[model samples]
Target chain A: MSTRKQEFLAGARNTFPLLLGAFPFGLIYGALAVTSGLSVGAAMAMSAFVFAGSAQFIAVGLVAAHAPVLIIILTTLIVNLRHMLYSATLLPYLKKLPQTWRIPLAFGLTDETFAVAIHRFRKNDSSRFKHWYQFGSSLAMYLNWQLWCFLGLVLGDRIPDASGWGLDVAMPITFIGMLIPFVKNIPTVVCVLTAGAVSLLTLGMPYKLGIIVAAFMGILAGFITEQTGKKIQVEIQV
Target chain B: MTANEWLMILGMMGVTFGIRYFLLALADRIRMPSPVEVSLQYIPPAVLIAITLPAVILPHGEWHFSFTNPYLVAAVIAAGCGLLTKNLLATIACGLAAFFAYQILLSS
Candidate 1:
């Protein structure tokens, strides 16, 4: 096999575990999209085009609630703000690649791909094919998401009340599962607590602005905590 | 899709792609500040918690903090599973099973 092909396969293989977690989420998005009155084609198109799982779920909810187009766009933009961080982190490594390679890779840089790609980039290998590895992981996740989404769309048509069945609860559970491993420090704990409390307090906000507000507040709180924690550590060292 | 729905999808397409493509395209030109870089580290946990809390705590658009709120119960169970196993599949499985069992018991 070519070196590029090997890197790609390795990337896909590394992403397999993450794909297991994403499968159910993608399926839920598909079913929920249909439940939210999106046509099958539109729902599939979203999975194809937008390709961001959390944003897609939020979009479906906004659509179901008859939110304005501007609101949906803004809400999704808020939910996807984390992508900028991912982009910033990966930028240095991708700077050498041409636009042709960078564009598609950026388009495929989902959370799962970012995790896998960053890990690979941090390795001390001199291979020029690292981007190919990212491409592999991205392709694997992209294809896996599309497959599960299509299955969900098909099943969604059969089960009209999929949302009512409380399967949607899995989404929050999944997020909690994803969140716990990251709570390794006071800053992270503070971030999660602030975000959770604020989201609960702002539950009645219009157009789901509560989430956007809570997210920004949480980020701010965590940022403050992280800076203070560093200062304390520096003082202790002195 | 209606024209409006199509517009929303297309609009989302443009915005989502725009965000992902923005910084990477300009990576060579702009350097991220240290403060912003530190803050970005918290974005994932903050955003995920912000999104998840409302759904788990207020599933029906109302505050349901009691035992009848299967989502809250299951979310707690899922968090426990996450802490113990630190495994995604295990956490999700435990959560779904807890939710289904709660549904059955409550309905009965």
Candidate 2:
């Protein structure tokens, strides 16, 4: 097999665990979207077009709340603002690629894809087609999302109180798994602690604005901790 | 779907794509500020914690920080497993097992 093929398969294989985690989430989104008043077509369309899982879930909740269109849109913007950072971090590796590749890759970019692809991109590999790995992950996520969403739409009613099943807990667990490895240092510990505290304090913020606020607070805390650590090192050296 | 819902979905699509595309499209032409670039390293950890912390602690959208909260228990167990093993599979498996076990214990 070609190197591209290897990268692609590797991407898919790595993301498979995440796909399993998202399965119930996609199903819950579909079932709840319909039960919350979205038509079958619209629910599927949202899954297809607005592919961000968390954002789509929040948007559906807002829809059920009868929130104004502008609020829903605004909420989505804030909730997904993290993706801006994602694109920025990815820019270094992907900047040289053509728009055709970047566009689809960007469309397929999700928390899961970002998680899988960034590792490969950060690797010291000689493969020029690392983008293919991202492509494989993105395509897998997109297709996986659509398939589960459709199944949920079809079998949603049959599942009976599907939203109460707690399958969504898989996502948070997976996130914990992803995040634990990052809490190795003082700065990262500060970052995670601050983010957790701030999110809890701001939990009542509308449209889940608390998430953005907490994320920034965490980043700021981490940056300060790092800077302070450097300053202490300088003082000790003096 | 109604025209209004379609409009909302389109609006959502546009905003989501625009945010993701903005930086990737202009990456070569533009240089991020030093602070923004430096802080980028913290984005993954910060955002993931921000998203998951509340969900685990407040599984029902209500405060439940005690050991009685299955989500909290599971998360603690998962964190331990993750730190010790540095393995995703072990973390998730341990977490779910703890979660189900806690659920059964609490309900019983």
Candidate 3:
């Protein structure tokens, strides 16, 4: 196999673990989207175009609620704001690629892909085929999401209460599982704790604005904690 | 789909794609501030926690911290397993099993 093919396969292989978690999540989103009054076409279109799982989920909910278009747009934007950070983080590694590669890669960037791609990028392999690896991971995830969503849409039609099956619980459980491995230091712990607490407290907020608020608060808390810790270390040294 | 729904979907596609592509498009011309760079490291955990906590702790959009709330109980078990094993499949399986088992117990 060529080096590009090898790197591509490596990307797909490394993403297999994350795909397992995302599959069920995508299924739930599809079923819920249909149940929430989205047409099958719309649900699939959002999955294809928006391509952000959490944002799509929230969008379907907003549609069901008969929320105004502006609200749906704003809410989805807030939910997906993390992608900007992802873009920023990956920008340095991706700067060398042409527009053709960068456009698709940007569109393919999701939480799962970002996790795996960043790992691959940090290796700083001397090979010119690193972007192919990321492309492989992105393509795998994108296709996996569409397939599961289609299954869920079909299943949702036959079973009206699929969302009520408590399958949605898996989403949070999976997230917590992902979150646990990252809590290796005080800053991370503080970030998660603050975000969790704020989200819980603001659970009743309309349009799920609480999520955005909590995200900002958590980032702020983590930044301040790190800065203060650094200052204290400086003071102690002096 | 209704025209209104189509509009929403298109608008979302625009916004989401715009955000993901923005920094990459300007990769050479722009530099992220140091503070923003440091804080970006925390975003994955913070955003994930923010999204997950509400769903786990309040599956029904209300406070359900009592033992009878299977989601709350199952989530704690799942988090414990995740911490102990650091395995994705195990964590999900343990969580689903706990949730279903709790549901059975509740009905019984």
Candidate 4:
């Protein structure tokens, strides 16, 4: 296969698990959006336009609540601010790519795409094939997302929201599953616990700003813990 | 709604694409601070907790919690199942069952 084809294949392989996981989420979102008073068109449009699962979930909820358009937009911005950081982390590697490649790749960057791409990028130093890996990983996720959205739109209302379906919990369960593997150290543990506490305390904040605060606090806690660990190591060496 | 009614939808799409693509185009021109990178890691967990906590702690359509609240019980069961099985499908099944069982018990 050509280099591009090889990369696409690799991307598909890495994204297989993530794509499977996201399928139920798209279905759930479609069902929820319909029940939440969004027309099928709006629901499908959201899937097509936003292309971010969590953001779409939030958007549907906000629309249902009759939140002002500006507030809804602002909430979406805050919720997705983390993507900017994802962009920053990949900056060093992506900076070397052509503008055409970088722009398209950036549009394709989602949690699954970033997760798979970063794993590959960190595992090897094959600088020449960076875009190939990114393309491979992101393309699979992108296609998977679009496919699931389309399926959901077609059969969403008929899916039936019930306990037996158990699709609503897919998202939360997926997140917990993802988090467990990453909580490999004391710093990560501390950050999660501290953030959880803060988020709980500020749960009533309007517009979901508490989420932003909790995330900020968790990041701060993680950074501080890392700095402290480094200081101790330096002290011991001295 | 008709296609003509979807001008707003197209606008939303334009805005989204702008956010995703604009940052990449501007990456070389501007640098993000160290703090921004640090905070990004916590976003997923924080957002997850934020969304989940209200569903459990706050009863639907009410600000307070009570024993009658099935979501709370279901959430506890769900969390336990999540830790034990470490399987998404299994955990969700457990949670959904617990939630419905509570609702059914209360109604009956």
The model with the greatest DockQ is 2
Order the candidates by lDDT, highest first: 2, 3, 1, 4
Q: Pick by lDDT: which candidate is best?
A: 2
Q: Which regions of candidate 1 are displaced past 4 Å?
A: A1-7, A10-25, A28-38, A57-75, A111-134, B1-6
TM-score per candidate: 0.82, 0.94, 0.88, 0.76
Q: Give me the candidate number with maximum TM-score.
A: 2
Tell me the tens digit of each residue's lDDT in model 3 across B1-108: 778778988999999999899888878787778888777777778877888888877788777778999988999999899989987678878888899999999989
Give the C-alpha miss distance for residue B55 in model 1, angstroms. Answer: 1.5
- The lDDT values for all models are 0.83, 0.87, 0.84, 0.67
| Candidate 4 C-alpha lDDT tens digits along A1-238 | 2376676688678667667668887877776776767777777767666677877777778777876666666766766666665676677667767788987787777766776676566565554676787887777777777787767766766766531354554454444444444455777777777777787777668656776677667767877887798899999999
lDDT for model 1, on a 0 to 1 scale? 0.83
TM-score of 1: 0.82
The interface RMSD for candidate 3 is 2.1
Task: Please write out the lDDT profile of model 1 over residues B6-106, one tens digit for every residue.
Answer: 88888888888889999888877877788776776676677678778888878887788889999999999989988999776788788889999998999
Ranking by TM-score: 2, 3, 1, 4
Candidate 2 deviant stretches above 4 angstroms: A234-238
Candidate 4 interface RMSD to the true structure: 3.6
Off by over 4 Å in 3: A68-70, A123-129, A235-238, B1-5
The candidates' DockQ values read 0.62, 0.75, 0.69, 0.31
Question: How much TM-score does chain B earn in each model?
Answer: 0.88, 0.90, 0.87, 0.75
- Sorted on DockQ, best first, the list reads 2, 3, 1, 4
Model 4 clashing residue pairs (backbone): A11-A136, A11-A137
Candidate 3 backbone collisions, by pair: none
lDDT of 2: 0.87
